[model samples]
Target: MALLLLAQIASGDSGRVELIAHPEVGAQLLTRDTTRAIFAMRQRTWPDGQAVRVFVLANEHEDHVRFVKERLAVYPHQLQLAWDRVVFSGTGQAPTRVTSPTEMRERVATTPGSLGYLATEHLDERVQVITME
Candidate 1:
């Protein structure tokens, strides 16, 4: 049932949406290396040395937050702690939180070297989705 739903979502409108990536962006986001890259702020730069911005769905949506947490095997609380540590240390900033998927997609598309995830249902021509293995 879940597989069917994902397929429906993934194939809904290929023309309206596309998965995007930096030239070096890999296929899967859940792997240890990919996850590390996505979170470490190292992968934020593009092939041109542009800074990458990350936009994330706000925590009000339980399912979305759970998806990221579970896929990365890190609880929300743990993520918060890590964010705080990074912020305090002046190393990196936590993802910019937005109220809706629409907002997330907009911000990601406009911001150079930006990357983020949105519901397949919410995807449209304006933005791109990067595949995750």
Candidate 2:
């Protein structure tokens, strides 16, 4: 099931981005809406109720741009605006901003309840790939 979903997401583009979550996040599949909400910092927990820790690359990073545009189906600035509102309003916190893909993978792998994205080539067993519905 996981492999099928992964192939479907990774099928079209050579430069695709995929979700990499902490091994303990406890969800094999998440609705696209839920994933978006999480990245937007609107949703604070996983389906099983673990506090979510979202990680993202700088706005200008290519993989970050692709993940927002392709997987989340939102523009980079749109996501940034949502985050700005949350932080500016003091309602919630922004997702952790990592400097590079290696940092993204490292943080997500070591942080429990964390979620992040990486190019297919950077993925390894340290983290689990989650499929978006």
Candidate 3:
């Protein structure tokens, strides 16, 4: 199932949502599982062991939906539930929510070890785009 999903992303236009990270993250690549874990609040650090911080757009936002579905291959409701469970269980915290892509970019760029997704046009050199490995 994971292989199928990765194939789908590889064969299709997963470019609509681009995974981005703070420049301080250092690593320029991540596997789908790692990316999913980070966004799902299950991973607390990058591959290099730097603390991971996640930023996101609102749950109902279109970009958020696309990023969750295309990039993470998970439905937004499912992701939200996962976050809620972790937060309520005292095992994790929810991602920082931003109102727009500009804010998303800004927050991710400024916050060390931050990771997020953005539409191509909204992206800038403030953050680094990590390739799916």
Report each candidate's C-alpha RMSD, comma-separated, in the order given. Answer: 5.9, 2.9, 6.3
Candidate 1 vs candidate 3, TM-score winner: 3
On lDDT, the leading prediction is 2
Clashing pairs in 2: none
State the TM-score for model 2: 0.90
Q: What are the lDDT figures for the candidates, one per model?
A: 0.57, 0.89, 0.85
Ranking by TM-score: 2, 3, 1
Q: For residues 13-98, write the lDDT of model 1, one tens digit per residue.
A: 32232333333333323444465455544455544556767666655566456545655556656656766777889988887787
Model 3, C-alpha of 10: deviation from truth (Å): 19
- Expressed as tens digits, the lDDT of each residue in 14-114 for candidate 3 is 44778989987888888988899988999999778899999999999989998899878899999999899999999989998999999999999899989
TM-score of each: 0.67, 0.90, 0.87
Taking the tens digit of each residue's C-alpha lDDT, what string does model 2 give over 65-96? Answer: 99999999999999999999999999999999
Least well predicted 10-residue stretch by lDDT in candidate 2: 1-10
Q: Count of backbone clashes for each model?
A: 2, 0, 0
Stronger candidate by TM-score (1 vs 2): 2
